[model samples]
Target: MKRQYLFSAFLAREKCLLYYQGTIRYVVVTADSGERIQLGLKHFQPYFSALGLRGRFRLTLTETGAFDSLEQIN
Candidate 1:
């Protein structure tokens, strides 16, 4: 079963990638749109929620792309 989640993110430079359990999956944003990043959290919701992550998550941009470190805020 695959689940999809849509959420907004703030990237360092608008370009980023999505990582699930140390594996990169989706590219969230691009350098041209360096403001806000929208992520399509697909098929990895269970893994993400398992780590107690829900709602909006923070993203950090690196040379590769944007990644969620699974840090949740209440």
Candidate 2:
């Protein structure tokens, strides 16, 4: 069986008071009905910048959580 998830990814900036940096890049997504997935700057920046920033997308991942493909939804 194949497993898939629908998520809406968007760029977010989190404020950091302790660190020298003012904000950090983050990718936040609604993974399931009520689940949220967040990725740091290094994890999702490439994909988010290319397409995800626009709107929702369908994510296909392996059982081990490896990225397979991503398609933007209309």
Scored by Cα lDDT, where does model 1 land? 0.40
Which lDDT tens digits does candidate 1 get at residues 1-74? 22223343343211223354445554353333355454455532543533333344434445456443433333
Name the runs in model 1 displaced over 4 angstroms.
1-34, 47-56
Top lDDT prediction, candidate number: 2
For each candidate, how many residue pairs have backbone atoms clashing (under 3 Å)? 3, 0
Compared with the true structure, the alpha-carbon lDDT of candidate 2 equals: 0.54
lDDT (CA) for every model shown?
A: 0.40, 0.54
Give the Å shift of residue 42 in candidate 2: 7.4
* Top candidate by TM-score: 2
